[model samples]
Structure formats: C-alpha cells, structure tokens
Target: MYAIVEIAGQQFKVAKDQRVFVNRLASEEGQEVSFDNVLLIGDGDNVTLGAPAIDGAQVSAKVLKHLKGDKVIVFKKKRRKGYRVKNGHRQSLTEIVIEGITASGAKKAAPKKETKKADAPKAKKATGKADDLKKIEGAGPKAAEAMVNAGLDTFAKVADAKPEELSKILSEASSRLAHIVTETWPKQAKLAAEGKWDELKELQDRLDGGIEK
Candidate 1:
C-alpha cells in the first residue's frame, strides 16, 4: 500500500519503510510522528481519496535525525508571500522513515497523549506558564508570538532550539517576520533559563538586533 500525505507543508507519496527528508519538525530524533493529512491511499486496485485531507487516515513515521540541506545563495523561505534573502543558507531538514499507513481509524490523539504524559510529571503546575520571549533582541512581538505558537513557549525550549529551526518557524509563521535574525536567541534564552539575568543583559547589550557585534 502507498499513501500521499502532506508533511511539513510538502506532500509526498510514501510507503512502509520508505525514507524521506522533510522540513525540520519539532520532534526529537528517534521520536515517532504521525501525519494525519493523508490525501490518498492506494492498495492494489482499490483507492481512497480525501476531499482535502482524509479523515481518520494517517501516516506514521519515525524521525531519524536532523540535518542541513545543500547551501544556496538565494535563501527562499517556504511560505506564501515568502521573500528571499541575499545571503547563503542551508535548509534544515528532518529524516524520517515511514512506518505504516492507516486508511481509517487513524488519529493524532495517541501520540499527543503520550507526549502530554511524558511532560506532565516534571512540569505539573508549570504547564500553563510561558516565558516572555520578547526579551530577546530581534524577537519582536511577531517573532516571539510565532515561536510560542510553534510549541517553543518556554525559555528552555528556545535555549535548546537551533537558529535554523527558529528561522524556519518564523519564516513559516509569516513573511513579515521572516527577516528577524535568530542567531543570538538561543544563547540569550540559555542565560535567561539559567536565571543569569546579569549575563543575559550583558549579552543583549553587546548584540545588535540578535546578531553578535
């Protein structure tokens, strides 16, 4: 059986055990992720299609690793109204191998539940709290809001995030926010997460719009 599914804004024809490289996702390496936007499924002579996306039809895959694509001179961020940068860039990608395709009775709740359970223990009441990301230079209201919407709501998550990942998330969120430099965000976030206000302020003072000076 094979399925056509949308993953990270791109559609692919995938089958069991087939490997694919997709845009960088929030999932960690070795994590299992499912795409519910299955467009069509085919088995032998039988086929099923979706009106836009197939409900209860899902594709499961395992994240292998994160990597960078070939460098390019014209950096084209993928989004409607996306603009190009005049500098070189390497696209961030995630390698995944399709595990299975379910034509029906497939939902994203299972994995989400597991994720919640995994996070519930340590966070407890801290779940609802989010850091004020506007403290980071160049991460204006739009950029900060974009990162929060992408599940990097906490300082720790931002601290651990790569600049490329942040850039992709920002670019995907909106074309207007695409140009915000994120190079110093993680470093600033790390200091903030560690409660080193003095150091973070010093770092911010030395930065020029999130770029090291």
Candidate 2:
C-alpha cells in the first residue's frame, strides 16, 4: 500500500518502511511524527481519494536524522553596471521513514477557544477613507490590506515608511507578500500624497511592478 501525503508543506508518495528526505521539520531525530493531511491512499486496484484532504486519514513516520543538502550558488549582476552579488545556500532537510498509514481515526486537533469578558465590547474596525495603496506598483489588494491593518492607511504614512519596514509588514501579512520588492513603494507614495500625478506616472512608466528597470 502507498499513500500521498503532505509533510512540512511539501507532498510525497510514501509507503511502509520507505525513507524520504523532506524540508526541515521541527521534530527532533528519533521522534515520531504523524501527518493528518493525507491526499490519497491506494492498495492494489482499490484507491481512495480525498476532497482536498481526507478527514481523519493519517500517515505516521519516525524522524531518522536532520542534515543539510548540497549548496546552491546564487549569483546576480547588472549588465555594465559593475553590480554583482554572489551567495550560496544549503537547504535543511530531515530524513524520515514511514511507519504506518491509517485510513481513518486520526483527527486534527481542535483549536481551543478563548473566552472573552462579558462586558468587553468588540474591537472596532478602522474607519475613514483608506488610501488607494494598490496604486503603488507592487502593492496588491492583500498587501494594501496588510498596510491598512498595520495602521498605514494614508499615502503620507506609506510615504514615511522605510523599505525594511514595508518588507516586515508584508512578511507578516502573508507568504505571497513576502517576496515583494519594497524599494519603490515609499517613493511612489510620496508622489501620490503630494498629488504629483504627472511625476508619479513618469516614474511608474520607468518601473515594472514596483521594481526599477
């Protein structure tokens, strides 16, 4: 029998006693781990598939070891600009051997509910006209919402932001926003806050998705 399971945000097809290397897991070596996000289970000609993920299905494994993979070279350069950067990275990985596969009975743990004080009023959402931060090249709806939630609702506030600060906000917002290039956001926000549409247009024209050409 074989099963397709998700382990540490990556998927793998695994079977009994099969060893697999996956992204780093928090569990220590010799620890037992179980994944509840089983996608499919197959035995001979019979197969069971999940709607997104099968409820109560689980795959258990024992962590064998933790190690780093081969180094990867990262090189960047700007043509004729005398700009070059080189780096290397080795991926953290964990080795595990599948021990068992259960088609049911292993359920996800329920989150505990926090009880609030009876007299406490609910927190109010931020009010007032939110600036159109999406007007900035790299700022999508989610990114704009993140900035708003971080109390940066006005163009002036965004204009005063540092690239590192914006990067932190986006990183906390979502994984999708983590890769955004924030170098141009404050400059764009400054132009917009000052009502310099012609200048903003000219600058955006020279940019591609908030990145300098």
lDDT of every predicted structure (CA atoms): 0.80, 0.80
Indicate the residue-level lDDT of 205 in model 2: 73
What is the C-alpha local distance difference test score of candidate 1? 0.80
Question: What are the runs in model 1 whose C-alpha is more than 4 Å off?
Answer: 75-86, 108-213
Residue clash pairs of candidate 1: none
Q: Report the poorest 10 consecutive residues by lDDT, candidate 2.
A: 116-125
TM-score of each model, paired residue for residue: 0.53, 0.56
lDDT of 1 by residue, 1-213 (tens): 999988876889999999999876666799998888789999999999899888899899999997778977755565676765565556667899999999999754543355763665533323459888888876888887788877888889999999989987886676455445677889999998999999988887676434566
Model 1 earns a TM-score of: 0.53
- Error in Å for residue 47 of model 2: 0.9
Give Cα distance to truth, residue 76, candidate 2, Å: 0.9
Candidate number with greatest TM-score: 2
